[model samples]
Structure formats: C-alpha cells, structure tokens
Target chain A: MNEQSITLKKKPNLGRRIGDEIKRNFVLYLMAIPVIVYFVVFVYLPMYGLIIAFKDYRPFNRMGQGGIWGSPWADYYGFGNFVKFFQSPLFWSVIKNTIYISLLGTCFSFPAPIIFALMLNEIKNLKYKKIIQTITYLPHFISMVVICSMIIRFFQTEGILTKLITLLGGEKQNYMINEDAYRPIFVGSGIWQGVGWGSIIYISALSSIDQELYEAAVIDGAGKWKQLVHITIPGILSTIVILLIMNIGSILSVGYEKTILLQNDKTASVARVISSYTYDLSFGEGNSDFAYSSAIGIFQSVVNIIFLTIANTISKKVTDSGLF
Target chain B: MVYKPSIGEKVFNLFNILFMALMIFICFYPFWYCVTCSLSKQADTASLMLLPNGFTLATYKDVLAREAIQKGYLVTIFVVVVGTIINLIMTTIAAFLLTRKNFAIRGFLTWMMLFTMYFGGGMIPTYIVYTQILGLEGSILVLLIPGCISVYNMIVMRTNFNGIPTSLEESVKVDGGNDMHVLWHIIIPLSKAVISVMVLFYGVGHWNSWFNASLYLQGTEIQPLQLRLREILILGQTAAEGDAGDVSTMAENIKYATIIVATLPILLVYPVIQKYFVKGVMIGAVKG
Candidate 1:
C-alpha cells in the first residue's frame, strides 16, 4: 500500500489503466462533460459544415436530411465553387487587397510595439514611465467599436483631420471617403490602436534581461545606445521572432470587422478584403451563393494554415522558439 | 550615483522624454477630442481645434435621451455582466478538470480544444451552423452561448492551474472534501489574479462586441452599446430631428457624446486592473 509497492507492483493493461483513471477521476470527467459538449456543438459541428463549400448549397435545402449532413460532396460540383472563385474577376483584387492591407499593417504594427517597448525601457523616472505606459495602454483596452468611432469622428468632411489637411494645402475630402487613402488610414489606425498594447510582451521581456549584462556593458564604457543595440535587442530577439511568426501567421486573417465598419462604396475597391468579400457575397444583394462564399472562406483558411506553418518553421530554424 | 555630466546622454534623455510624451499625447488626444467635441457648441465643433469652445452639455443630454442609446447601454451591461460570469465559471471548471493528472484522454481533449484555435469554419459556414442547426441567430443567446468559454482564456486558466502545487488539492482531499469542495475552497481562491484577468478580458470583449450581434441579430432592440454607437458614428446616421445642416452638426456632436458614454464605463475602471492585465500577459507569454 506504500510507495514502494505502488512502483514495484505490475502495471495494468491499457484498458484497465484507462478504466482505473476514469474510476479515480469520475468527478473530473463529469466536470469536463459540459466543455466537451460545447466544443462538439459549437466548434466541431461547424467545422463539419465547412464541407458546404464543395456542394451546391441552397439556403432552404433540407436541413440535416438531404443537405449538408448528406453526401453532397460526391456530386459534379465537387470543385465547381473553387473553380468559379478562381475564375471570378474579383479574385485578384480581393487577394491583392487582403495582402496589401495585412502586409502594411504588419510592417508598421510589428515593429512599432518593439520600438515602443525599447523607448519605454529607456525611461528613468518610474512615475513618468507609469503615466506614459497607462496613457498608451488605455487606447488598447478601448473597444474596437469606440476606436473606429473615434477614427470616423476625426476623418469627417468638416472634422479636425479634414480641416488640418485643408490647412496644410491638401485636399479637403473626408479621408474615409477617399479610396487611395484606405490602406494608410486602415494601417495607421491599426498601429495607433495596437502598438501600445502590443508592446506589453516586449516590455515584459525587457524586464527579464539579466541586470549584470547592463552593468558589465556600462563598466566597459559602452554607451547606453550601444548597450541597447547589443544587450537589449538580443535579449528580446527570441520574443521578436516568436511574435513576428505569429504576426505573419495572421497576415491573411487580419480583422474584417474594422474593414466592415469602415468600408463604404467609395473605398470598397481598395478596402474589400477576402473576409469582407465572403461576408458580402454571403449576405449582400442577390448574394445567395453560400457555397461559393464558403469556398472563399476555405481558400482563406488554407492559406492561413500554410502561412502559419511556414512562419512557425522559420521561427524554429532561426530562433529555436516557435508557436506550434 | 555620482557621475560626471555627459551632454549627449542628457540630450538623449530629453529627446526620449519628449518622444514618450508625444506618444502619450497621440494615444490620449482622440479621446480628449471626443469629450471636447461632445461638450462644445455645435457650430464651434465644426472647426479643427484642440480645446472645447463655447462648451455646453447639450450634445450629451441629446444623445442620452435617445431610446436607442438607452437600449444599447442596457443590453451591453446585461451581456457583459452575465456573459463574463458564465465565461469565468465554464473556463475555470474546464481548466481545472483538464489540469488533473488522472484525467483520461487528456491529450485528446487538449487537442480538441487547441484545434479550434488554429483552423475554424469561416463566416458563412459558421453562420449556417448558428442559424440552421443551433437556432442562435437573431437571439440574444447568440452573444451569450457561442463564446461562453473562450479557448484562449481556457488555455491561460489551465496553465495557471498547472502552476499551482498539487499538494493544496491533495490536502483538501485528505480532509474528506470532494472535488467541488476543493475547487471552491482551494483552486478558486488561489487563482484569483488569473480569474480577475479573465473577467476583465471577457468583460471588455463582451462590451466591445458589435460584430457578432451585427451579423446575427436583426433588430436594434437586442443590440449592445457598440452596435448603436457603430450605427451613429460609422453608418453616419443622424440621432436628432431638425433641418439638414442643423441636425447634421448636432449629429456629429451627438456621435462624439455616444463615444464618450460608451467608452467611459470601461475607461474608468481600467487603471485599477491595469497591473493585473500586465501580470496576466507576462505569465501567458512565459508559457504560451
């Protein structure tokens, strides 16, 4: 009955071992039931519905009997939806728009946070640092809806942003209504919203660097800038790489909600990305092509998976740290 | 601490301080503008300005009196409070159970949860599931049920639970207490920081969520604050009745008022829990 006997005793078979585990942890399994049910219903069941992409789906088709739950994927329209998407005139623009916005966002947003963290680390006064940090981080906690609202309020025709542009000898149109201005506005607002909060991890990483490294550098007559370039960046390099990989992983999956709120007919040409395209196609005027839009969604998810895996692998090779 | 003055270092320090102050100004200026715009006289608010001119509470009074804004506030408060509670309970129970060493098929269960994180059925397919299968579309339950237990939060809570020493639970067991007693008496008490973090995350998520409601629900009555704010601010709808120019100016100011009213609830409480969120991120970054 003691520890020696428990270790010295013959091991049980796999089935017996599992049975014993269940018997011993019945309460835990009972607790897990609801979570298991939630995933099954919400997550797994919907994943199964992704197959509607391959079928000729109609909305009011028999719910479970002859529609999605049936063997609809074996028909002639197996790849018709995908073919139609590939052949569509909107295809190239959607791809270009999504990538353009995402890459622009990543280019600025990914580095802005790192630089913000580095700058914050340089501050000597704790009160000033705390004040600056709180002010910067406040915008992050503000809802995206509020953030978008603020953006629109600033960019209206007679709004402050427009007035400033007119004063500076630029055109006086609302930036939101300008098609060419879409990427800059979207990416700029994205950085303004996320840069402060994104710096959280890097700041946390900065705190973990061994103090002795800085002390040694100081004794060696290295300037603060040199010490920063050497000790600080290297200390946070792995975090940067890991975060970069994640940022790249989400390149295709950048937010659609913000675009949905911001995109009007004037800017839709530049602002219409893959997710929004899918949303529009599914619910827009005469857009009952559920199957077709579902195909687009599948295209996005596949590309996202590929991008994530590639970035993760590159991260593992370069830094020995990856998201996996 | 006693060192000779270096002019370059002093210059660098001055520059850093100025740049940081600029950063703070950039982040905070928009909110400041929103407040000042809401309070400024409608005509004065039309021009580009830093500070409020001819200040009045008319816009705030006007926006708040609207039935739409009131409904939005009520729905948001209900969803945030109720959804966060449901989220915390479900997440804690799931995390606690998953962290148990004796739980069978643990790896499979973990994989099931994590799989959803990487790949998901996109909007149309998920919309079908919600509308056709679950009958959640157009219902308030769409907001409440689908995201009752966020997978990311579950992972964080589970990681936190795993960090706790098993001896605490064992001691409760030794005292002839059941798993529920151990969870209530030990795990819940010990995981307060992480629990609070999860609460804050879920609260903010629910409060700011307009996308799902916008997609699912058809009516404005059950919509949350963010949705109403979205319509007023982004959709460029006028909230007041008047002549074209007069109402448009009032609408712009009223939109700013709505922004302040919508954001102030969360903004007011952020400072107190700021440290907890930073701590949460630090802990999550270590393992996640």
Candidate 2:
C-alpha cells in the first residue's frame, strides 16, 4: 500500500505538466496567438528568406519560376557573391568611407553630449538650463528629411553658410559637393541633432550621484575642480563606459537614410558606405542584384555582431560591466 | 559653512554663460531662418538671412495649395493615427501577456521577441519577403503592418507592467476577472505614463518614416509627407521645377515653406509632450 501511494504521488511528466498549464491558462495563450503569428510571418519568415544570400537569387528569371526556392546555389560552393564583393574595387573604398565616417562621428559626436551635460550641470540657474535644453532638443524631433533639407540649403552655393564662408575668405561654392566637407558635415549635423537628447541620460546619471560625497569633498578642502575630477567623473564613469561600448558596437551601422538624402553625384565617392552600396545594388536605378546585395547585407550584420561581442568582452574586462 | 568662488571660477562662469548663449543662438537660428525665409517673398529670399526680408503669406498659400502636399498630409495623418493605435494595441497585449508570471511559455515568448533585437533579416531579404512573397509592394499596409510592434518598446512596456503589484492582479483574478480585465483595470491604469511615451515614440516614428515608403511605394500615389518633401527639397522637383517662369525663382521659398508645414505639428506639440519624452528616456536608461 505504501509503495503504491509513492508511485501515485509522483508528479506528472514535463510534457503533461506543460499541457496542463496551457489548458489552465488557455485564455492567455489565445491572446498570444496574434503576436506569435505576426512575428513568424514578418520577422522569422524573412529570416528564412536570408538563405537567398547564398543562392543565385533571380527575381524575374526568363526561363523558370522566380523565387528564393527556385534559385540555384551560387558559384564556388555558395561563396560567389561574397567573393565578388571582396574582389571589386568598390569594396575597399566603401569600407574605408564607412570606417572614416563612423570614426569621425565617434571622435566628435560621442563626446559632445558628455561635455554638454557636464557644462549644463554647472549652470546654477534653473530657468536658463531649461530653456537651453528645450531649444537644443528641438532638432532631434525634426524629420531627417527636413534636417537634410536644411543642411542642403545651408550649404548651397548661395546659402547662408556659404556666404559666411565667403566672408571668412573661403571660395564661394556648394560645400555639400566637396568631398573634404562630407565627413565634417555628417558628423557636425549628427552632433547638432543628437547631443541635447543624448545628454539626458548622462544628466540623469549626474543627478543621481550622491550629494553627500560632494559635501564631504568640500569639507575635505577639495576645490570645485578637484571635486569634479575625483567625485563627479568617477560617479558617471560606468554610464560613460556603457554608452561608449554600445556606440562602438554599432560603429559600422551608420544609417543610409541620411547618407542617401545627403549625397549628390559629386560627393557619391565619399558618401557611399556599406548600407548605401547595398541599397544601390538592390534598388538603385537599373540595378537589381538581389543575391549580391543580400551577401553584403549579411556581411555587414555579421561584422556588426562581431564588433558588439568584442566591445562587450573588452568592456567587461576593463570596466567590470557589460551589456549582457 | 559659506563657500566663495575664486577669480578663476568667476571668469569661467562668465565664459560658460556666453558659450551657452552662443549655443542657444546656433540651435534656434536654423529654424528661425527657415521660418523667415518661408515667410519672405521671392525676391526677398535671396537677401533673407537675419530676419524676414519681406513678409508674405503667399509661400504658405502656394505650398498648401499644391495637390501633392494635401494628399501627402492626408496619407501621413492616416498612417500616424492608425499605425499608432495598432502599435499600442499590439504592444499592450504583448506586454500584458509577457508580464504574467503564471502564464506558461512567457520566458520562451520573451526570448523569441528579444532575439530579433539582435539579429534581423537584413534589408534585401526582408524586402523580398515584404514585396514579392507577402505582396505588400504598393500597399500602404506595407508601412502599417510590418512594424506593428517595436520589440524595444514592448520590452519597455513589459518592464513598466512588471512594477505593478501582483496582489492587485490577484484581487482582480479572485473577482473572476480574466486577463483582459486585469489588463484593462490593473495594468493599463497603472502604466499610463509608459503608454503615453509609447504613443509619442511610435507616432513620431510613423510620421518621420520615409525610407521604407520610398522602397516599397516608390511610385504610389499614397506617399507620405516626408517622402514628398524629399522629392521637392532634395531632388529639386518642385511643381515649379519644370516651368521657366518667374515662379521658378520662388522655389527656395516654397521649399522652406514645405519644411515648416511638415514640421509645424511636431514643433507645436513638442513642449507639451517633452516631459513624457524625458521620462521615457529615463525609463529606458534604467534598463540599459
């Protein structure tokens, strides 16, 4: 009798327990169906379509049905497109431009917010700070199209910025078409749009630093500069490190939207990055090499993942904090 | 104890104030210039730098009178309204379900959603699926359907929902309330701040989106305002572009006017919603 009771007292198997849970929460499960279906169709199904990166995908084949499944394996055992991309002269220039632009952005745009937040924190008057923040944050809400339009207008041959340059003894020309001006313009505009908004996180971090520490430092004969160097910097160091890590991880993902809108025929050589190049191959006028573009896309995604992982690892080693 | 600043500190403070004033001018002047130029007449626009050279409402009237601008506004408004509603509903349901600790498969479902944030089918493959296989090529549904729920926003909402006391949900459950009732009464009421933030984020996103529309609906009549702005502002395809008449000289004024028209709503509503936006950033920073 005891043995029989022990056998009956055993819990149900994992599958049976799950089945019972599902039955018990059937309403919740029913509600989840739409989200599941939406993800599967819109997100996961497209992931399956990523396999065309390896295939010679032809959307409008004359001789056969045109689809991912209908495509054949690429040359060199499915490495043909990537190999072609690597071999092309456009590859190095594209990579160089992407890195150049991103590095310039990191050098300037990354630090702008940190400095702005630090300076803003120095202002004792509340109303002045509020007004400054409000005006500065407005550009972030403006549409990229509008911002780019403003940029184009400002840099036109007869534009305000051009006139200012002429006043400063520079030649009168459309600076937007100048290759040398592209990186500065891109990075400068980015800082203009993002600095105020990005500073919010750091400002919050700064505010959260314990006031008691500053009081203690003041009592200990530390000057304002010393207090800032020792107390304030260390307090926000972790926030700074984390944001930097994230920025480094996404170093290669300079979005093509602004680049596409900003680039003209003259500056295309400097402006074309990995993403815009992929866009051009796939959708630019008279070009529809799906397989090639997909290969490039996959390449970019993989490199980005690698960068993220490396950054995370380094951050963990140095700062003892990481995204994961 | 009283504290006094050194002479160096006083000079630094003065310099900082001047620097801040310069920054404010730099930030405000661009939009101000746009406004002044938009309000300026055609001949005055060339000399229109500091202030309104010659004020006129004709530019606004002309830009607004264009059929394309009117249609663009209608399409954008439709997408922003309908898309945000769909975004809220889908995000709310997802967040509610995922926050239910007692719900089985919550972990699995959360992971499934979170994984997409890291890895996504890059643009071309997604385009193929969206355009060829799914047949959303020329449809406005292409914009509204595919981006129904931003996973990051859903995660933020889920975080907010998790903060609501479980006892409240349990009380509703004891009253024979189902998941929907718990969401309606307990979760939604408690999470209004986050929901408003979500609405702002999603609404602005829909309003500013042009790349996807440009890709899928290139030649479609239902192009959004930003895309239309791009055509006129960037590609220099104003209604006056083809004509060699005097109206062509007003192209710059028209472009400036179009920008103001497209951006006015956001600027008008910004101050009221600014606090919520800052709050949203704070909440996101907590997770980060």
- Give the number of the best model, judged by lDDT: 2
Q: Output the number of the TM-score-best candidate.
A: 2
Quickly count the clashes in candidate 2: 0
Q: What shift in Å separates residue B36 of candidate 2 from its native position after superposition? A: 0.8
User: lDDT by residue for model 1 over A156-236, one digit each (tens)?
Assistant: 677777787788898876677788877888998888888888999999899999999988887888887798889999999
Candidate 1, B146-264: lDDT as tens digits: 87877888888888888888898899999988788889998899988899999898998898888889889866469888888887676653222112344344356677778899988
- Candidate 2 per-residue C-alpha lDDT over B17-49 given as tens digits, one digit per residue, 9 for 90 to 100: 998898899888898889988887752433437
lDDT of candidate 2 at residue A198, scale 0 to 100: 88
lDDT of 2 by residue, A131-151 (tens): 898888889999999999899
Candidate 2 runs further than 4 Å off: A1-8, A13-16, A60-64, B43-50, B237-250
Candidate 1 ranges with C-alpha deviation above 4 Å: A1-20, A62-66, A74-77, A315-321, B1-5, B46-51, B237-250
Error of 1 at A124 (Å): 1.0
TM-scores of chain A, one for each prediction: 0.90, 0.93
